[model samples]
Target: MKILDRYLLKTYLITFISVFVILFFIFILQTVWLFISELAGKDLDLMMVIKFLLFASPKLIPMVLPLTVLLSSIMTFGDLAENYEFAAMKSAGVSFQRTLRPLGVFILLLSLCSFFFANNVIPYAEYKFINFRKNIAQVKPALAIAEGQFSDIGSINIKVDKKSGDKGEFLTGVTIHKKSSLGEGAKTVIRSKKGHLISSEDSDLLQLVLMDGYYYEDITPKNYKDREKMPFAKAFFKKYNINIDLSKLNAKEGEDDEITNTHSMLKISDLKYTVDSLTTDYNKEVISVADNLYQRLGVTNYYQVDSINPKKPKTPELTSFLNNKDKFRVLDVASSDALSSKQNLEMNELNFRAKKKDINSHWYSIYEKFIVAYACIFMFFIGAPLGAIIRKGGLGLPIVFAMLIFISFHFLNTFGKKFSQESGITPFLGACLSSIILTPLAIYLTKVAINDNGGVNFDFITEPFRKISNFFLKFNKQQ
Candidate 1:
């Protein structure tokens, strides 16, 4: 909005674009090479490959954005510092922080944009990118499946003799073994006389059409009067479709089931609703289980207490036939009642414990997912401030820095979550640990830059601690 803001923003923007473009292309080249290597033996066309790349680019942007922010901001500020532009601004009665004010706003905006991209756009793009690879693999499985090498496709292990291009199919001499739940005994081995891979129109499928094959299927039977010689034999145009449950395979790759794969783009309200639903459900389960357990525990404890603290005897009685017989009858009556109540209490306790566990599990799931959504804003602060501090505008350095931070965050968050589930850490703490780690770093960087002390070689400072640690160990060992 202000003239100064616009001027500094221009610098940051130019730096941002330059780094993004260069780094993106380099990434593209690497990915393309990987794609080529992956598609080495497959019948993948140029257009299919291009489509794969196109789908993949958006996914790359989210990953690159944080790095781009760091590099660009650093370069822009470093250049301003180097050119005496910052000094000129200071001499002209503008404070260093005042000059940084506009850039701060820019960083804020960039962080918000990154959040949007990470949460909405990138989730979808990443889902698509994963699917794109899957689709490519599906289309040209010649590359995916190798000759003479066993490949696991679903619950089946298949080995093919050879594949040819001119015919655009795989040859016979195929041995297929299928596995199932019946202790690996439910097996199917198809020694096909001949086989070919084919696809139908508009269908994302490939079929292994086998001809004149004797199918050997091992059956698990409760009782067998006489076993059949061969399970099946036919001069068959057997159509085995090459289809993958992409949704099932790529479920974790996206938000949930890839079937629920959404472009909930910029829909904060939607996420809020979903988050609220989970929270409500989680709380409901907690209250419900806790209440149920409390009631069961109360009943059990009350009965047990009543049993232990029996009514005081009217008086100490002298031994007599009537009194002794009456006490025995009383004992029999109390034992019957106590046994029934004890059994009921044990059942209630078991149920309460099981329900309690479910409640905790549900609560944890909600906590972890919510933290993931909030990570957008937290990561922005970490990334933008880091970018400003590092002041290296080219993609190479910034990208590496961004990745290290994010990947570290990602890995820790996941690790913490797993531990949290087992009660090794609190779920809430585990969820927010990444933000906690990054926030202080962001603040420190902003402070450093404000004081005109920007970008340190952290490695130099860190080396002493490491050296001292190593030195002490060696000295102690020698002694």
Candidate 2:
């Protein structure tokens, strides 16, 4: 390699590594803060905590890697420009584009690596992370219930005012709401002055022992008039025992892949397969529902009307051949059927909308794997050119510029995804929205930098304000 190319690559790599480490550390801290509720007071061992962080760290690459590329590029090129090294290189017949070639190649390789990581490592980590959390709750039943807020476990919601003991197994002021099998909400409520959680490593059940508890069961009477009484069954107990099954939460020694169907846990290929299957199923469901509604509404009977009768009006009015009583009966039945069909259609519409949103989410996830890879190259071009144009270096101005640009990109990306999920736009467009909006800016910066144009000019903006100010001053003098 030429000396100049080696020098530029060395400088860029140093800056990139330093910036990446600092940013990754900061983001890891942010991740911890974000999940502090789940991690804190859980009595997790050091290895478990480290495992949790390690599993979560892969997902942060898409966010951190692009920012690192942008910030490091700006800092490296900005310092070189501020030191007049660019001028020396220019005098030596080295163009700006030549200076970028070495680092650009490095970025291209990095982008490829990012794509592989997103397609393989990230999905695996997401699967492990989620299942790890579930297993934690299973192995340590007390961790499932956080003090002062209700936590849903299995078919019951449990809340406690205070918890004390080695594993927070001793609870005070415990409350439990058992969900009804009939889908009528929580019909049974249990309150205890104190409770204890008992579990064994070998078993898949956690037993709750309550002391001095009251049980209240809401009763619904069959008769409408009797229901107005608002009846309920109440009983007081000195002690009670409830066993919660945790078989679903069990995680084998080295395999925690129990829950793996979420969109984020699927690689691009898996996501494509899921999307295709879901779309086919959705279309088939719509067709089946339409056919069922048509049959239920008796539309076929009209088509079977006698076509051979010459005297029969082609479009005879309803009740033309029926008595008044029969006509009224038919009208009532028709109105009821119409109302029922309307309700059914409305329900099906909501179901279809939810399914469509799920499909869109999967499609967006497929695009996002590619987006993360491309974002590295995208941010590099923006930052490198912008750094040369601005001619400032170090942490002060480059950090501000990097943050502003990245924040805008992140915001637009989020907005587009949300809008697309709601059916406002296609998933491909949503995933590429930020890049589409910012490409022109990168091109402009690169063009101006190549032509030796300095930082962006605000003359057009300032000139108008200056003219308005002068006009106001002259008017004031005349007055």
Candidate 3:
């Protein structure tokens, strides 16, 4: 490599690393802020909180790396341009493209590394993070209960109107719906004016002590003939004590293996496999629905009618054999069949759309692997050239421009992904929409940078108006 290439590459790499660390930390802090409320009162150990953050951090890499690349490129090239190093290089016969060459190669390699990291590391991190969250939830299952919402703990769904006390144990206006274990239409409903939940760390039992409570239990009648008034028992108690088994929560060691089936938890190859399978199933379902609809309508052959003459109009078959009542009945049955068939087809269509959405999500993730990687390449082209063109260095102007550009990129990406998921557009178009939009801008910037004498012409935008004003002035002078 030449000295200039090496120097530029070294500067770019250093800036990129420094900016990446800053961006990564910023993103992590944002993540923590978003989830801090839910995580704070859960009594999670500090190490567990750190582990949660650690597991969650890898997901930010694909986002942070691209932004950092844009910022670093702009800062590096902008500083060089502001320092007149570009002029010196050009005087020494080095073109802007030549200056960009080494950095471009470096960015291309980085993009590839980013792709592999997203493909392999992101899935693992997602899986681990999901399980870690589940494990944390199990750590203090009672903490899952929020005021004004029903929370299911084992067989009982508990709702509390208000909670207070040192550990949020004292509850007011509590309601518990205990589901029946037996296969009977039986349930026990309990309401309390006030309640307190007490649980020990070592014990696999939760004591729910209620004050001024009423309990109602549904009773099944022994005789069917005497069931006109279904029996039920209601009782009021000054104090009610219920023991809840917490063994399940304690025993659950994040056994949610099915969470790995989520689209976020799958690698590209796994996603591809899932997408193919879902597509095949959807196609088969469509064929099956069509066949079922056809068969249910009793249409033997669409083109054939029971007639000797090819062109002869046959009498309507149903009216010929049946009276008006039978005809009406047949019509009613047909209407019902039609409605049923319509419902089935509608359901099938919904399922197909859902599968398609899932496929789109998988494909989106797959495209994202490349999109994020290529973003670095794209951003560099944009940032580097814009920096040189603007002739501004340091954090101030570069940061602003980088933020504006990144926001635009992020917005386009989000809109495209959302539209694709809704089946508004194809996955390929949606996934590549941002890159497609930015590529031209990057090229434009690069072109301007190459042809730029000293700076790009900002007055060209007003030149047409200036010409019109000049024309008006000339006319006025003639007048």
Candidate 4:
């Protein structure tokens, strides 16, 4: 029995490690493809790209590990059953549960480690990943601008028809639009035949130099006849220089703390603190708004107007006291004041609700770490038992089953979280929705495997569709 347990454990670990490596590599390759445009042609060093992937990899583990567990478990148990090893163990009076004991212990420890990594390591990795991308953008401002597209950098919008040269320093067919941040009327437009970006390590600015450009400025007309003419000034320049301030965009030595306020950068404890503080503050703000509105409108409470003193000029009915023009003026003033107050109150309420919703989302994220950790154990139960029942080995059936199950689980989790963030459901239910559905399924699969009952015959699933196809064929032949 001891020997059997050791063999099973060894095989399971080997398969798990192999599956994890392959899946992790595939996911990393997908990430590379997604970001290739941003990182490519930016003169990025190999080491920097490697470091970016490293920082980004931790967030993928929580997604990849459970799928790995599912696939590996299926492959391991399916191989054993196909080889008649399980039948031999059963003949020797070893139950399926007993055979699973060692692997169960290993899975339990792995779940703990997963939780610790998600709670402790992933946050730091996410923080670093965000800052690394930002630094990369700052390193080469041109990286922010894609070829043949308009890119917004600060107050200026730049479009390049093409970029060439070894370092992407030469550009052609450049158009620059300078947007006015103030309430000024029109934008300044500059079109150039060619342009190039100049940068220096010592200076915190990006210089865009253009040649043979035309600048256009719209001049506001002074009168109706001037407006009919639609006056504007255009100038041609041989050379032009525009300096963009890069002081804020450039990476600083110790700005990590400033960017760490995002929800992805916080641990469970920090998330709980934020949720609690925000809830308290939101409730206080609600109360304050109610109180302030009551005082402003001179009402004793929400449902009543004060009438403590009879002689204190009982609120006069404007329609009864005023006539014609005076009544219109008074009503107009009252309506305008009421509308302004209502708008202000509504805006404040909307801001408050948005903040509260954000706090709920953070709470969901906090619970997700633990939920994902337990998914590993649940996936093992599902995959192992179903695999034994199917009696198929290798990647063929196991990979398909694992993907279908994981995609369903991922969809449920994402949908639930989105609904929770929109306040349609509680955060607890949203975070645990996938686990709740999968737990019963795992238990059912275990029972079926233990009882030697075959789990879902594919023939049964396909029978109705097969009959429909046969009916159509017979009708077509008759016709």
lDDT of each: 0.59, 0.87, 0.81, 0.82
Q: What C-alpha root-mean-square deviation, in Å, does candidate 1 show against the real structure?
A: 9.9
Ranking by lDDT: 2, 4, 3, 1
Q: Mind sharing the TM-score for model 2?
A: 0.79
Per-residue lDDT of 1-479 in model 2, one digit per residue for the tens? 99999999999999999999999999999989977867886667898899989999999999999999999999999999999999999999999999989999999999999999999999999999886776676566787788899977778999999989887889999999999999999999999999999887767688999999899999999998998898999999999999987743333333432243488899988999999999999888877786677678776444433222213224535558889999899999999999999999999999999899889999999999999999999899999988887777899678978998999989988998899888999999999999898888888888888888665863564477579889999999999
Cα lDDT tens digits for candidate 4, 332-409? 987987898899889997887788778878889898999978999999999999889888789877787889899999
Q: TM-score per candidate, in order?
A: 0.58, 0.79, 0.73, 0.79
Q: Give the runs in model 1 whose Cα sits over 4 Å from its true position.
A: 1-7, 22-40, 60-62, 126-148, 161-173, 179-188, 196-207, 216-432, 452-459, 462-479
Model 1 CA lDDT for position 256: 51
Which residue pairs in candidate 1 collide? 70-387, 74-391, 206-242
Better of 1 and 4 by lDDT: 4
Candidates in order: C-alpha RMSD to true structure: 9.9, 7.8, 9.4, 6.5
Badly placed stretches (over 4 Å) of model 2 are 146-205, 209-239, 245-261, 301-317, 323-325, 458-479
In model 3, residue pairs whose N, Cα or C atoms come closer than 3 Å (at least 3 residues apart or on different chains), thus clashing, are: none
* Poorest lDDT segment (10 consecutive residues) of candidate 4: 302-311
Model 4 off-target regions past 4 Å? 145-155, 159-175, 179-187, 191-215, 220-230, 234-261, 300-331, 455-458, 461-479
Candidate 4 TM-score, C-alpha based: 0.79
Error of 3 at 178 (Å): 6.5
